[model samples]
Every structure is written in structure tokens, then in C-alpha cells.
Target: MLAAKRMFSLAVADTDLFLEMPSSTQALYFHLGLRADDDGFVSSPKKIAKICGCGEDDLKILASKHFILPFESGVVVITHWLLNNNRIKSDRYKQTLYIAEKSMLEVENGVYMFTGSRMYPERNQNGDITEPQIRLDKSREEKNRVNNNGRKTSRFTPPTVEEVQEYCSERGNAVDAQSFVDFYISKDWYIGKNKMKDWKAAVRTWEKNQRQKNKKSKDDEGLEGWLNA
Candidate 1:
């Protein structure tokens, strides 16, 4: 079940942190909040921006100001989501499908804060929320355990095909998730004779390499046509 309405706090909207942004960015924030899931995740922020006659710069501003948090997959989460809608009944609350992204966040003082390798928001002496600060010395280790022989082991876990597809969809990339998994599986999840530490990073690397390869191919075709002409 889904809630019928969304809520906003003046504690957020009335502050300089919110008012200092461009009007389009503020409007986009409202529209995004209206369309976000019960957990405050907006999976199609770019599409929403397009529909609202807003530009990428509006989204970027909101993200930069800590009004929203952008994931590499193109999804955005409202930073003050919990503060805005804390009264919703649990029965009507539907969890977001972005579990991987959700897992990296933590609620602090009724606001959503990132727990991973990203900047987190805080307040200054004036009681106004300030820009994000780099959270240092945080470990993203999945798990550590001792084996039967008393040797500790920590292994990299590969993402599922569904997760890969979802991440790629959020990123608006055309990478074949199944093919990526199969190729890594064939190599026993090793990247150039070393164990792959992060699959998401590898995906970005693949996307980058693919784009360069595609550009080179087009340039080569252009050169061949010119030679023939």
C-alpha cells in the first residue's frame, strides 16, 4: 500500500539551506518528494526533472547542497526524507527496491545520512545545516569470519544479475548485465590476475572503456570515408 499524500517540514524549507538554492531546484525538490517512494527514494529524478521543465543543473544543485543524495545509478534520495514524512503508518509504507543504496544510508536526528564513502551533512554554530563533510576512516567491509582452521577470511561477493540490471538501469547505461556476470564468472571474478574488490567500480570501468571504443570506431569509419572520397 502507498500513502495518499506527502509532507514537508518548514524546518527544512524555511531555512537558508533551502532558500539559497535556485527556484527551479526548489520546485524540482518538491516534485521529487511528491513522487518518491515511501522510503523517499526517487528512481527517475532525470525523468522527473524533464517533466517539470527543469534542467540537469537544477538536480546537480540540489545534490551539491545536500538537499538530495545522488547515486551513480541516477537515482536520488531526499536527504531530509524521514524528517518530512515521519508520521506515515507502517502498514501503508512501502520499502524502496533500491536495497543496495538504502543499505549505505543511516538515519540521524530524523534525517537520512550516508554511511559509506560519501560526504555527510552537519550543522554549524547558527543551527543551520551546512554542506557535507567528508566522512573519513570508514570501512565498508561486508563481513569477516574465522574458518574452521581459525584462519580469518573476507571474500568479495559478486552482485546478482538483477542487481546489475537495476544499477545499470539507474545509471542509464546500456551495459549487458548478464554478459558482465558471465565474463567475470569465467575469470573466477579476477580482474587482471587480481581479485575484484568492487563490482560497481568494474561496471563503471567497462562503461568508460566501451564509450572510448565506440568513439574510436566512429572516428576510424570517418577517416576511411574521407580516404575513399
Candidate 2:
């Protein structure tokens, strides 16, 4: 699932890489920010390129500049993801695919300078440096597990824009998949009043609505010409 929000640090403007990079690279970075998980990892570059119109060259450029680190597993970890974003509460934070990729990253000479450090610093009872405690409030956990309607919270993963695009294309519909994604994303993946239980259902709904609207427009145009003739 995508993050509800992500920080774009102003510090990037001061970096040489940001200034020197081409517009295509800059656009790719921005799209990655939108699609990345809470851990700042983007899973599939090919899919991202298809959706965002940025090419693989952009990924190579970012990785070469140390702005991103690419893994053999096809994962790209944004170097400054932790630096730019505010820390999330441990319970709400989803585990990243990076756990398994970190070892491969290290072997590949990828930079992970913050490992075992205080990304989420916490003080001990004695006010001394200590390991960060993962404080999971039982009540909050239970609340998330069950919705207001008493249904179990959905395990539904939000589809990326590229995935939506493919689905729409398969049905020969001209639905604006990105716009659909943006709308739901803005609402924190909720429908009109509830959390979206199924995103594919939403996609199908959009496809049906768009197709019906198109057919009505064509029929209206034909009727108008026939009446005039």
C-alpha cells in the first residue's frame, strides 16, 4: 500500500545531484515519492516507468549519484527516505521488503549508512541511550483490526497506477487510471464513507461508468444529426 503522505525535503534543492539532473530524472523521482511504501522502497521499476513515462536510464542515473540504491532483487531504496520523512509509530508502520534486500544491498556496495542507528530514537527510563522500544498500544491495534461496521480490516493492497492502467487497457476502456488513483489516494484509500474493501471493484465501476458515458454521447450526436436531416 502507498503511504498516506510523504515529505519532500527542501534540502534536496541544495544538493548537486538535484541541480544537475535532467527533467526526466526529476519527474521520475517525484513519481517514486508518490508510489513508494512507508519505508521508501519502490518494488518494480518497469511498472513505474510504464505509469510515469520515465525510462530505466533515470533509475541508473539516480543510483549512480547515490540518490538511490538499486538491488539485484529489482528493488530501489531511496537513500534519503528516512532523512526526509518523519518517523511513523511502530505499530502503524508496515514492514518493508527491505529487510531481505538489505543484505544484498550491502554486498552490492549499496549505501545503508543508518543501519542499527537511531532512525526512531527513544530514551530509556534512566534517560540514557537505549534501543528504541516498539510501543504497540493494544486498544489502537484492536481498533485497526476491526472497522466501525465490525468487519475485519481489509488486507487489500492498493494497486499502482500502472496496474490500473493495464486493467483498464485490457477492457478497452479509456478510463484515466492515474486520476482514479489520485482520487482514492487523496481520500486515504476510502470510498465515499468507508475504507475501500476492494480496489478492483472500484476500477470496474470506473470502466463501466466511462463506457456508458461515451456510448450516450455518441448516441446523442447521431440523434441530433438525424433530426436536423
Candidate 3:
């Protein structure tokens, strides 16, 4: 998750699966492999494709080679992941969140029975699936919490230089956007020990600090002028 060391086996590049693919596809394979957990599961292939500047077609290529498998839910599980990466059998290597995907892997033959249920699904009195009904006010609140993308809307994304500049201008503060961006970029946009929660809040804190420094400078200048007069 953090920028740590990762291993890439030479066998991957040597295999027909790697050599046959276009350079872009090869690179995508490595990226997915490196990011996958011990069980070789990567969430949201579509999102990964967008981030890696690849396409769905590339994912299909990997899937065809048995390098990866895509689930209907957009998760991609890397095949034979255990062969390359080593993990301790402790807490970190415990239960996986991709139990459904792992189960689907066993359907090499005709898919016999489909199992697993939706997360946070609405169920009726008889345990039948039904549309969830909520108060209009609560529905609006929930809608606001999730973005257009299925992501939980609360995660922080680093603001662009233009965004920082515009926000500082709107707040009437002379906070240096470049300085702010550079500082965070060096730290990989982390605030304290965690990923930044709110870039706007960080900007506000910078603005307040800048205002105090400017006020102090002006006071010093006024003191000099008074002494001269």
C-alpha cells in the first residue's frame, strides 16, 4: 500500500505470456502483479486500466493467458499468485476479502451453482431481494456521501496546482500553491502518518499561517517606521 519494495520474478518476462504481449500489455501485467495482495486479488480492473492508461482489451489479453481473471464485480484475481510472492502465515496472510472470486476460480468446468450475495443489499421479510426504501432526507444524505464513481467519496485525492491556486485566491490568502504542492508531493501527499483526509482543510491551515506571518512582518515594519519618525 505504501511505497515499499516489491519483487518481480524473471520468469514472467521469459514466459510466452509476457513475451507475446505488446509492451503496454506487458507493463500492465507487471503493474497488476505488483499491486495484487498475497492471494493475487486486485480490486476494480476498470479503475486500474484507467489509472495505467490501458484498456479493457488489455485486461482481456491477460485473462485469456490465465494470467488474471476478471469477476463480474470488476475485481481481477491474478492466477498462480502464490508461486511468486512469499508471505508469513500470520494475521496479514489470513482471510481474504475476495472469497467469492476465489470460489469462482473453481468453475473451470460448467458453472454448476452460483453463490454469494450482494454487500449491504436490501432484503424483504421473506429474505427476498428488494429495493431499499429510505426517507427522502436520508436518501439525499447517502447520495451526497458517494461520488458518481462507486468509490466512497470521502477519500482524499491530491489537488492539482490550479486547484490550490484557485482555492487560495478565493480565500484571499497569499499561500504559495507551489510550495504547498511541493511539500506534499515530497511526502506523497500524506498528512502526519496517514493519507491526507482533506486538501481544502490543509489549505485553510496554510492560509491561516500565512496571514499570521504577514501580520507579524507588517507589525515589524510599523515598529521601524515609528522609531524613525
Give the candidate number with the greatest TM-score. Answer: 1
Ten consecutive residues with minimal summed lDDT in candidate 2? 107-116
RMSD of each: 11.0, 16.9, 17.2
lDDT of 1 by residue, 1-229 (tens): 5576999987678777788888999999999999888888999998999999999878867765668877756788998888785457767767889999999788776778666334445676766665544343224545666899999876565565666787899988889987887567545477997988889999999899889999999999999999999
| Lowest-sum lDDT 10-residue window in model 3 | 110-119
Please list the C-alpha lDDT of all candidates, in the order they appear: 0.78, 0.64, 0.61
Per-residue CA lDDT of candidate 2, range 1-229, in tens? 5558777765553454476788888888877877777777789865887788888777766654446656546777776676565346787788776788654332112124222221222344544322222222335433445678898774554555666788888888788886887667555577888878778789889888888999999999999999999
Q: How many clashes in each candidate?
A: 2, 0, 0
TM-score of 2: 0.45
Error of 1 at 88 (Å): 2.3
**Model 2 CA deviation exceeding 4 Å by range:** 103-229
TM-score of 1: 0.56
Which prediction has the highest lDDT against the true structure?
1
User: Candidate 3: where are CA atoms >4 Å away?
Assistant: 1-5, 89-91, 106-229
Candidate 1 Cα deviation (angstroms), residue 13:
1.4
